[model samples]
Target: MSHEIEIHADGTAAFVSANTPGWHRLGVVAPGPMTVPEALKLGQLADWNVRMEPLVAAVAGSKCLECSKPLGDKHDDMCVTGDHEGQDDSRIVDEHDTTHAVEVPNNRAVVRTHPVTGLPEVLSVGGLDYTPISNEEMGQTLQAILDQSGAIVDTAGSLRGGLDTFITARLPKGIMVGGADPVELNLAGFNYFRPGKSSEFLITPVRVVCANTQAAALYNFRSRYTVRHSPNAPQRIIEAREALKITFDYRDAFADEAEKMIKAELTIKEFERLCREIWPAPDPEANSAVKDRDDALTGTLMQIFKGETNENIKGKKTRGTHWSGYQTVVEYLDHHAPVRGEDADSGRIRAERALVGKARDTKELAFNLFQVA
Candidate 1:
């Protein structure tokens, strides 16, 4: 499955792409760019009225275990589920009353009512304080950005069975790096881990070329806005219009940096120095395993640099340029870096880090180093 795109219980793909089809080639596809409202409807994200509901457990009991008193409609003690090492202290059988529903404290179920059936499906669980930002609210957020920025919806979808959701918008124009490759800017909004605690917005600039360049762009996000879910989250989202201004500022700054990188040439020695700084030589006493990995890593980066320089960008060769070196590091980290496990879950973990986690920090370091070089 492409990025574990969520498949709804109704067998429809919970994704939609505008203008072009995604790699998975599933979900709804639009022939042209869409407004935020259009994208939401096509993406099956229009009616997910997500809300928090109290979690309750059924306990059968007439008398309290400790005091032998007639247990009323409520029970305050701890309860256990099923059989395990501990005894089933929660369930008590009452001849008069078979079951009494007691609310589980400190936790809630994230639920969405089915539009057609009126039934409810529990999407996930969270603490009592965890607030849900409904799909309608997220749509309004996207619409607000489009109204302010003149951007069009590019794609929208849910991942991992609607546990995580996202929407991306394409900016009006693109920056031409090195007077050749066009780097397009996109605004991505994401809510992770099943109506997570916060929603994240980021501006990403990507070269409209190869997968490597796209990955580099994904790793190159420099401006971000985050709003934690709370009673005031909706108001904060409304105020997030300021993010559009920040987006333009970040675009201008990135263009300047890209121009500098493309013009500054790197000598072979300088390239070696850059590698040494990024991946310091292991101590002599360090195990052979550590040293071997480091050596292999540096070697791989060198190989990538040579290949990148040879590939012509818009009729201009990037040979001996810091731009080539920067691409080398980004491509390696994004595609060639060693990650634990070979499953889709592991891929998601790596992708997450590449966006705003450890890999992001490393990419930024490389970019800064090249700017000085």
Candidate 2:
């Protein structure tokens, strides 16, 4: 598949083109297992473990757990039955709707407190814009959907929530778990098993990377062995202090190489064409970043920084609020104090250092084996 990524000479990341054609993507958002929260933040943040396609599934069901819904699956992954064709399932059921088991919409949405960050965020599930409200409020009129997805990673030590580690296992499509009930797994166990404090569900989310292939397999192996991230002071920064400090579902190495491959694969002209497609402008690729007026899209990245001066960039011109969104990230890393461990670089992160961490951690920490595959 075609892709677009930017890598620096130092093997660091620049950015991965989310608009590349023929590129399969697995978006591993870094906020909450709650789809709504992650999606909301995705529309705001940067330096996340971006992929070509969503690979994980939000686990559901209780007891001898059965397969349920999946957040990221190919269109043909599964199918559901409905009443008459072209009619809403409810209408058929209403023969007072003889209808039953209708196909659900894909673009799901939601916003909720994360297991760790606790910061409220928007999540993207099945389709993209799923609502966080219970299906009962909309579906069962009293039912709710509580699901989360990602690879299973063990906890570092322990914590509250009776969950120290957890996994985001996938269930059969449409299946769900409503409240705090227990579920069991066969060989793999539930995708997300919040066992108890100190050991619970953890997701090693692999993005657009195809797990069926050798590359993805190698990636998972590395995740099992890599040293975990250690957070310093300022624990109150956000609920994600511990959550974001994790290293799983290795996309670090793949993201790194992919970024370089994307840049090298595209010439300056190709890059321009892609920008136009994904983020088009009237005069794309003009000699100067700005054409005639001082619109956000036209202005130079430098000009935006100069005018905004590290202020938040609204999505209006920057698209995805690139300016201010990126600025927020820069500020986030800027406030990150030095590390006290032997694993990560023992330095404070800043504008450049933040991205440096991003590059190193994306696929490296996610899946890269100390020994090359």
Candidate 3:
């Protein structure tokens, strides 16, 4: 009997037995804990058609079943090339193939004829085993982390297109430095089926008052955790939680460090020197194009210094100190970095990484320059 996988809006999924007509929940399977076949059997839906709803719809990208090629456009309606061109006419051809003249599903690529049935068979690019890290699993993991850390969920939701999702939580109260508001923790996940990329989970830190979110850095005692879907993926999630715990333990230290940086003072000349060091001018021997690029970057730095950028540092005392300088660079990086893609989700990730990396580098520079103790 045929079976069907039913995905719910809450991110949970269940398998429905065609014959028995009952819903069976598919439990979380750690990476490498079981092969796809094993997972299918365990779910008792080995032959069931797996259907991921809007949440993971991007997972439908085409992957070559024979060559193990990476998934192509999830919404691609037509095959790029004919799978069978000069093959025997007796072989079954997909209907979508005008050249071969056979009937097949429009959404699938024809693999080959079924050995026994002699009928054209089609498969998705990811094949049957490329099960994604379900939204349900992601939600559960986020909740688990919050519970372990005694954090309360402040907000949670999935982005449009279901390509990305995030959960924000407020860390336990009373862990404040001076008069600073409580820190907020954000955990986000993405599903991208392209080559050289896999589903990923990320963690970041946000200032409660300012709502400024930055990439977690090692110096902050918090390194961003990325969990990829792999055979050992379940272990990775566990590792991520442990890493988060370590970061939580050092929250006080991180806040203290941040406060120190904010209070540190710098002269105008010192701030200029810091910017020069962080973004050096082109060498004398460099070509005009390179020089032009350097000049543009320098101009951006100057704009930040002149308060022309969107990074709001209004309450900050403009003592021309390292704090102001640091804020200027961060605002520039966070709000002005050029993104290369049209996809807003991908662009946001790139921008966040750039901001975090630049902030980390600037902090190191400050430390070396004696701007921060």
Candidate 4:
């Protein structure tokens, strides 16, 4: 999958990940962990100089406009473009072809100039409330907590042509579920566009048993802080550091939940029931394609839970436990689930969905379902 991780025209991607390569494996891969400054530089995420500029449009102008005043010594309309190619009618004079800039009301464009090329790229356009946050600002915001908490960045990058940027750091401590499965905690910070899509910070630390457990951490957790892009965004973001105190709370809660699931045993019938709840029976009027997909999905979930799938749940000692059932769903959604119109790039698409799309909701539902099952 392309991963849409902003591969620039010059062939460098705005991304960096620790230890292992990203899904598309295009950007910088650190041999070990990274400091915030190291990640920003290696990821090519610094010095974007992102800013907002007033949006304008060109329109036909009247000679009477500007009080018919002479522009400079030319004594011609300032808006005039000069010399018409074919003037078939006297009414169509060179001055009539004039166009002038007019401000577009309540709208602004977010742009970033390439530090080297000096070329500008428009990241997004929105109304008055849309504030542009520079990459430098984001780095500073994330750096505060990392400095205080002593966490080191593990992943840092931009997506969707740099419209969305992120930095993730692994905490010093981790939670060991039932004294076996290790779930580490990480702090993820994001700044993006859209009305409801505000900048956010979330905790993870899920030791990934599957290819996408890091993303699954984002999908599964509820503890987080968010701030909208407004005039006071930077200040609000600075204030967010206070929210970091909850890291211990989040870690404790996750550990407690995991322990509960580990202690709660589940039977084959219970597993089947949980699957049915998640992927409910299709209507009688449903098409054959829908039924086929549903059947395949249900079968896959069952296989993952029973160690019949490639995930090999038997290795984790989670078998016959509610924790096993929950992990099975997470693993399936993150790794085993099939993407429609699968291609060589499907892995990137799956990764994106697991991080920011419906798959996240599905994984959360699975976690909740197993919690009460």
Candidate 5:
């Protein structure tokens, strides 16, 4: 069996091995735990375009369209140098207002196929966000804050938290869509939880390939904490992640009938195993399992929650969902999008390291991976 194994930055591996001769392909396993978003992205890109660059999406414009500067660097602080590569928010000084236009370059990275395999190698020439943090600084508490509060936390089984929890809080208080307020957004404590008010709990935090919401949060929370929990603990993050994973699997496994080759008979046992692997059975008899919570907002978080849907994403129309508590948090962070301003020919803005509550005004919603042909 000919196989190609690729190691992702998150310590996960993608092994493409052949089965039943070269024609039949089998097994797309994610051995290690990564973020839920990472897994979902990988799964989607599996058969989609091999030419998209997710790493580039990771950073807004790692590569400069004007001077061809390599855009992405480590997460802390990346720069295009050489006059910002005409990158956005760049300016050209004029002695007498003589049209000193330093073309606000379209921070878009180039997508190219792998040179050797003839496959794609979505290279993100310059999608580096913020600045680089020194080992010393990373050990500080603020960095911990950044990690915990991403835009929309990942949901893969690998971790406890997703970006959704921390995206908005990572930035200054005043930033957001339609200029909403953070406290009004009311995203303080845990979701679907009151923490400490519940039962005795324990969870081993793992930044897995498929993370649940709590896992997503723990991934960030660990930065601030000392001794971490065990993998054996009842992790709500895992519970949420698995639930969503099952949904994704169900959706894709049944995407289209005529599209693919056969491997047709998916057994009940196999389906059950997938489910078990994805989520923990919620005391199955617990009535609270299916009930959605009411998220009426009166606190600081509520105001922002009310604003998340002023714009739309993939046509989901998040603003209209009126999911209450769940949505209120989204509104708080929507204001912090890394925007440049109007007059920008390219409707592009660098994605912030924090959670992305809303990307309505930006050019395109970024994909998590790069497609290298």
Candidate 6:
């Protein structure tokens, strides 16, 4: 029978199978708007291990343990004849040798030698045993979180590398803003494969009607939490929930800031200045090659400003505002930025990194530019 995850009314998770009499409680599901990785760890679904391979050696016959081949005369010379004085003269022994040929057990060796061949074989040595959370387990964890937090999954999928995954969940309704569209708060959870990189759960506020995703600038730090795939990962996930809950409280503040950007107008000269600052032209003293590169960037930014790029800039109010320009740069970086890598997966990773960095910079520029306005 297949094992299945079950969530009870009390928000506790369990693993159950037809053979088992009762549900095995994994853990109390944390109130989450958490990332898939964090949810898995918190629900006792995922773990980590340090893997090890064994080493071995032959007891006799100078045969190399790795290749299982004879090492010429050197090993042959080490074999000594056994001397049985009064017990048995019939015992076979090489002439002029007195030592018995017996398999000597080495305490350091983890694997035993073959009885007939007298050759030692390598074995796998288990270290830091941990059970990895399967895709199914992650799904269950996400469901439990949604049920407990009263949220619903908006989108979920595997990232560039199948090992890494992401899920975006819409928080409970009632978050609203005046003079602008009602704000929809979403919690995005990213589960990545790398060790120290961990996984992240971040809160993002989006304009409900336009569906434009907004980044929390000053509040970004408070809105995200990351947990490494280590022994204490579960505990870390639990501790972070309190902080994550606080992010939801900032929804109104973030919504107000977004509305300001939407209303803030930008003229041609101001737009050019912002564009140059966001992707500045290279210094005049620099080489012609560098200048050319900067000029290319400048031209691309101009295209985005003129709505000539692929980014769909709808709604007249959003057209000439700082929000539109900011989103244009973000769209270009996220979708059109040139990436360098040997394979598709690597290229996607590089492109993601570039997008994140560019988006951060653009947000910072907006904050600075709008502060004076």
lDDT score, residue 250, model 4? 64
Task: Rank all candidate structures by their lDDT, best first, as comma-separated numbers.
Answer: 4, 1, 6, 3, 2, 5
The parts of candidate 3 lying over 4 Å away from their true place are 1-131, 150-183, 191-195, 208-210, 220-222, 306-318, 340-371
Candidate achieving higher TM-score, 2 or 4: 4
The model with the greater lDDT, 2 or 5, is 2
> Worst ten-residue run, lDDT, model 4?
70-79
RMSD of each: 6.5, 24.2, 14.4, 4.7, 24.5, 12.7
Clashing pairs in 6: 35-189
**Deviation (Å) of 217 in candidate 2:** 18
> Candidate 2, which segments miss by more than 4 Å at Cα?
1-247, 262-267, 282-296, 302-373
Pairs that clash in candidate 3: 31-231, 32-231, 62-125, 63-125, 94-102, 95-102, 95-103, 95-104, 266-321
> Worst 10-residue stretch by lDDT in candidate 6?
15-24
What would the per-residue lDDT of candidate 3 be over residues 91-166, giving only the tens digit for each residue? 2223233222233322223132322234433322342323445444554565666667665444332222223333
lDDT of 3 at 15: 28
What is candidate 2's CA lDDT for residue 101?
A: 33
Q: Against the true structure, what is each candidate's TM-score?
A: 0.81, 0.18, 0.55, 0.82, 0.16, 0.55
- lDDT per residue, candidate 1, 304-338, as tens digits? 88874446677887867888888788888877888
Looking at model 4, the pairs that clash are 1-345, 184-205, 185-205, 186-204
User: Which residue pairs collide, candidate 1?
Assistant: 60-92, 163-194
* Model 3 Cα RMSD, 1 decimal: 14.4
**Worst ten in a row by lDDT for model 3:** 50-59
- After the best TM-score superposition of candidate 5, give how far the Cα of residue 336 lies from its true spot, in angstroms: 6.1
lDDT of 2 at 41: 31
Model 5: weakest 10-residue lDDT segment is 363-372
Superposed Cα deviation of residue 174, candidate 4 (Å) = 1.6
lDDT of every model, 2 decimals: 0.72, 0.26, 0.47, 0.72, 0.25, 0.49
